[model samples]
Target: MSAVLISVAELQELLDTAGSRVRLLDVRWLLGDPDGPQHYLDGHIPGAVFVDLETELADPPSAAKGRHPLPDLAHLQKCARSWGVSDGDTVVAYDANGGMAAARAWWLLRWGGVADVRILDGGLPAWEKAGGKIVSGEEPDPEPGTVVLTPGHMPTVDADGAGGWQGLLLDARAGERYRGEVEPIDPRAGHIPGAVSAPTAENLTDTGHFKPIEELRARFAGLGSGPVAVYCGSGVTAAHQIAALATVGIDATLYPGSWSQWSNDPKRPAATGTEPA
Candidate 1:
C-alpha cells in the first residue's frame, strides 16, 4: 500500500509487529509558541519521536521569506533518519491541530522521495480520545543515516510561475487574509492576483477531522485546469489543502514560499478585496 492512513485502532494493532518498519512521528507545533517540546515531554504516542516544525522541518526566517521557510533537503533527510525512517519504512506523522502540522511532514517526505508515508487521522487528540497508549519520557538516541535528496518529486511554483501556469493557484489562507482586509501575521495582507481563495479550514469539519473525499471534490470542482498549486501564509496550512486535494485524487503542487514570500517582494502584485484579481 502507498502510505495508507491508519486509525488509532489500526495503529494499536500494528504496534508490536511493525515496530522497526513503521516510524511514528509527533509533529505537534504552535504558530508562535515555543512550548511544543515541553508538551511532547509531558506525553505522546508510545514509541513516537517528536519532530519540531520550526527548528527541524523549516529553515530560519529571512527578511524576504515566510516564518517557516523550507528546510535543506539533506538536513530533512537526517531528521528522517533520526526518527528511524528509511526509504522503505512506513512513516506516519501526527499533530494536535488536526493534520495541519502532520501534513506538512507528510508532504515533505513525499517531496524527498519517501513516498510511503501517511498522516494519523484526527491527530493526537483523536488517538487519545480513542484510548490509545501513551508514553512519557525523552526521545531515545536516533540511528542516523544519509538521505538522498530528490528535488523532482517536490514540485513548487513562484508567483510568476503561478501566473503563467494554467493550473489553479489555490490560496489556503483565511478569507480575511486572502481579501487583504486585516493584516495580522504578515507585514502585508492580500493574495496573489488571479488566485482563488480556498481556505484550508473548508476542508475540515467542526470537530477538526477532514471532510469526506466526495465533499472536497465537489467544493473544488471549477477551480482550474491541470494540477492545482496550493499556497498559504508560509506554506504550512497549505499542506492541509494539499491533503484535502489528495484525498479526492487531485495532485497539487505547493508554493513553499507562499504569501510570505510573494508579499515581501514589492515587484509582485498583490490583490486586495473580495474579487479574484
Candidate 2:
C-alpha cells in the first residue's frame, strides 16, 4: 500500500506486525513557545521519538531568511540515522496541532526521497482520545537503514519566480496578516506580490479538527489553479494548507522560506492593502 495516511485504529492494527519496521515520530513544537519538548517528555505514544521542529526539522534563522528555514539535507540525513530511519523503513509522524508539524516531516521525508512516509491522522490528541498506549521515557533505538538524500523536491520560488510561475501562490496566514493590516510575528506587514490569501484556519472547524475532504475540495477549487504553492509567515502554517490540499487531491507544493524570508530583502516587491493580483 502507498504510504499516505493512517488512522489510530489502522496504526494499532499495523503495530502488531510491522511495529519494528514502522518508525513513529512525534513532531510537536510551537512558534515562540518553549514548552513543546517538555510536554513531549511528560507523555507520548509508546515507542515514539520526539523530533524538534525548529532544531531538527529546520535550519537556524538567518538575517535574509524566515524563522523556520529548511534544514540542510546532510544534517537531516544524520538525524534520520540517529532515529534509526533507514531508507527502507516506513516512517509515521504526528503532532498535537492537527498535523501541522507532522506535515513538515512528511514533506521533508518526501523531499529526501523517502517515499514510505505517512502522517498519523488527527495527531496526538486523537491518539489519546482513541485510548492508544502512551509511554514517558527516553526514546528507544532502532537499527538504522541506509540513508539516501534526493534533491529537487523542495519546491520554492522567490518573489520574481513566483510572479513568473504558472502556479498560484496561496498564503496561509490569517486575513489580517495576509492583508498586512496586523503585525504579530514578523516585522513586515505585507505579503509577496500577486500571492492569493488562503488562510490555513479555514481548513479546520471550530473544534480544530480538519474539515471533511469534500469541504476541503470546495475550498481549494475556489483558488482556480494550474499548480498550487502554499506559504505562511515562516512556512509552518503553510503545511496545513498543503495537507488540506492533499486531502482533496490537489498536491500543492510549499514555499519553504515563505513570507518571512520574502520580507527580509527590501529589493523584493511586497504588496500591502491589496488582494492577490
Stretches > 4 Å off in candidate 1: 1-4, 145-147, 222-224
Query: What C-alpha lDDT do the candidate models reach, one value each?
Result: 0.81, 0.80
Off by over 4 Å in 2: 1-3
TM-score per candidate: 0.94, 0.93
Specify the poorest-scoring 10-residue window by lDDT in model 1: 1-10
| Residue 51 in model 2: lDDT | 88
Instruction: Give per-candidate clash totals.
Output: 0, 1
Taking the tens digit of each residue's C-alpha lDDT, what string does model 1 give over 108-151? 88888987788887788889899887788897865764456576
Residue 177 alpha-carbon offset, candidate 2, angstroms: 0.4
TM-score of 2: 0.93
Q: For residues 174-231, what per-residue lDDT tens digits would candidate 2 score against the true structure?
A: 8898888997877688888778888887887664567887888887888777888888
